[model samples]
Target: MTKPSIVFLHGSGTNADIFRLQTRKLAALLQPHFTLLYPDAPYPSGPGPGVLPFFEGCDPFATWMDDSSAAAEDAYWSLEDDDSGAARLLESVERLVREEGGGGELVGVVGFSMGAKVGMEVVRRLEGREDAGGGGVKVVVCVCGTVPYRGGGDVAREEGGRRMLGRGVVRVQSVHLMGETDPWRAEGEKLVGYFGEEGRKVMWFKGGHHMPAEDAVNKQVARIMLAACGKV
Candidate 1:
């Protein structure tokens, strides 16, 4: 029996090695039920508007999309045509399936902040090509997830996002965990809207812009993901 693999995407300024606090805990439980594949972002974190882009003191922190825009500092983002974020990320994902001999069944992806954007992008990009195989990422768990933006207005209606919404690759179902006090809470809500009325859920936690790191929170997070993947 092939063990279904679950991909874990780290946030901005963070790498696959640093599974965030919550992911570190959830990974413990996930070990028994699924294969966990963690992939680092392609580029090291760079100067963002004003938010010193390094995770703690970690060196070479990576990021998916470089937000080199003048719009709202932290709100505007653009992917260089040369280093497309989705393409780079999928490279890591596909590499894992082929080299590691895993992902015989891809159950889901749980991403945090910037990592969430990477995961979502993968889902959007693979929208119409599941026939090629290993592109079936239908379950998504967003922890402090940031909406993927490009110059302007959430681009779910165009390109990859359009295919995702149209259920081209898979009928993506999502579970979003947002912090009540997080400044990006509203943005997360807006992302939920993109998923439409059904097969989507948002849960509020008491904290700032971070995922729950406590054991209890980790359990609930795992439960939600397992349920979404129909593994529970």
Candidate 2:
């Protein structure tokens, strides 16, 4: 049987390199069962002095929008709705799936921090689009992130509520890995709870905003993601 493909979207301000370690291990362990693809984010590096090219930025290192600071909030909101860059990325995924002869394969997504946010957005977008292939992103593994605009006030709730409702009564399995003391924990749980009690998994670790680089945590995360995808 042909293996299902896994697409890795790096966090904001970071590139595909973030997934290199996880992908290598997962490919070895899940050999012949999964193929991995790590794509670069769409935005160009923002202007700044002393920037280490790709090595400088905030936590999870992301720039999902043109002007990171100016339109950060707006970018987050528009990410799932309809953005040219995001659309291009999704198109690339579709092409890859078809090219690999796995148009309806059991695909999974692993996203860290900002990438996790984007992954959730992608899932939300896929929920309604009939043209989307690859079996509806079977499982999603989100590390150190929460639903967009969940607690920003009434506007946030209304925006999130719409997407949640548009998800349309379908339960998608999700694994949320958060730091035990990570400030985002409460919000993360709220995001999970919004799923309405179906195939939602949560794990808390002793770390910060970034995913721990420990071998054990990486392995465990991969396992959780694969299991959610029905690969284990």
Candidate 3:
């Protein structure tokens, strides 16, 4: 049988490599069932202080947006609903999918923090479109994520983002893993709610704003990934 492909998206001021490190064990667990692709964010480097807390020692990270300051309150999430940059980001994902997925389309996506916002936004963009069928992402996993806005038509990257009602309902099944002490816990809760009461799950683990490193936690996360790929 052909293996499925899943994209791993990283948080702000961090490249795809960081997420790989964070989920190394889980990736190993799911390797047999799915081909995991970690696409590096295209934008160059971002503000020094904007880096994710877990990546404090990492150098010269990349970000999905052009936020001048990485302040938790100031940093905005979501693909600008009507911006060309959003299209570029999607194109980048598709390009990498074409190259790494071996002519196969992405089956699902797992994102962290800012990347989670991207995962959720991509689902919104593809909703009701022709791409919603098979070979498209059917599941999304957001780890310690924030909410995205949709009402405003043309949004700038630098705009202050307020959590508004999402533009369209997300038809994909989703899993949200939030940290007990994570600062942006509410945002994750709200995002899961936006997905509606069905086809979604929300869980809180012991920790703060970072992927759970415990072996048991990783195993559970792997099961989620496997289930997403219809391997379970």
Candidate 4:
């Protein structure tokens, strides 16, 4: 049987290899139920938050969009293009699916940090395109992510000192894993507000701007993802 597929999108300044290492444990738990796809971002970027010391050798990092010197929330306003990473990301997944020999059944997207923003963008585009194939995306898992933003005047309106959804609200089943102490925690929460109430789940992990490391947390996260993917 062909297992449902989930694309694993790494944070900015980190390649697919680094993301694979970060999620190795969680990947092990979900391996039987899902075919995970990890693709590098289209653009090269500097090292993200804590990617230096340990992952130094994992060079040639990438980003879905260009690196920003502005604050995280304000960064999207200056993006070179509105599509940014989503367009290329979708293309990469489609190529991977073809390479999977019909084994890739894309049902959901899981992204971290900037990758989370890219994931949401993919969901938005998929919802708009009636021709989007592969059973259509069913759910999205955002880990320490933020709201979607497209540059060059694509409905990125500001309200209450935060960017509101300009295109439309995403109604897909979604899961958000937030870091309790993450500097971007507030941004993550704002991202949740963009999704409809139904089929949405928010989880808080005990860390700062990174995936959960504890075995128990990892198990629970995997369970939630499986459940979201209708595997549980």
Q: Pick the candidate with the highest lDDT.
A: 4
Q: Clash pairs of candidate 2? A: 11-115, 12-61, 12-62, 13-61, 13-62, 13-63
Q: Rank the candidates by lDDT, best first.
A: 4, 3, 1, 2
Candidate 3 local accuracy as lDDT? Answer: 0.70
lDDT (tens digit, per residue) of candidate 4 on 1-232: 7777888999988999999999898899988888888888877888989999889888899987752433333544332355534555666777886676257667878899988877777777677674454347888888999655423232333441243355567778888889999998987998888777898989898999998888987797788777777777
Q: lDDT tens digits, residues 77-143, model 3? A: 4344444555567767778877887766677888888788777666666664545552367788889
Task: Give lDDT: candidate 2, residue 10.
Answer: 65
TM-score of each model, paired residue for residue:
0.76, 0.71, 0.79, 0.83
Query: RMSD to native for every prediction?
Result: 5.0, 4.9, 4.9, 4.2
Evaluate residue 127 in candidate 3 and report its C-alpha lDDT on the 0 to 100 scale: 62
Cα displacement (angstroms), candidate 4, residue 43, comes to: 0.9
lDDT of 2 by residue, 84-114 (tens): 4556556666676677645546367777666
Ranking, TM-score, top scorer first: 4, 3, 1, 2
Residue 87 miss distance in model 1 (angstroms)? 3.0
**Tens digit per residue, CA lDDT, model 1, 1-232:** 6777888887776666666444677788777777888777777775322234334555566776665343522332223232554566676787785666353666688888777766776776565356665366657888877765532344532443443345422248888889888887776775665554567778888887776756777787788777766777
Off by over 4 Å in 2: 22-28, 46-62, 66-88, 99-106, 129-134, 150-170, 194-196, 214-216
In model 3, the worst 10-residue window by lDDT is 150-159
Error of 2 at 103 (Å): 6.1
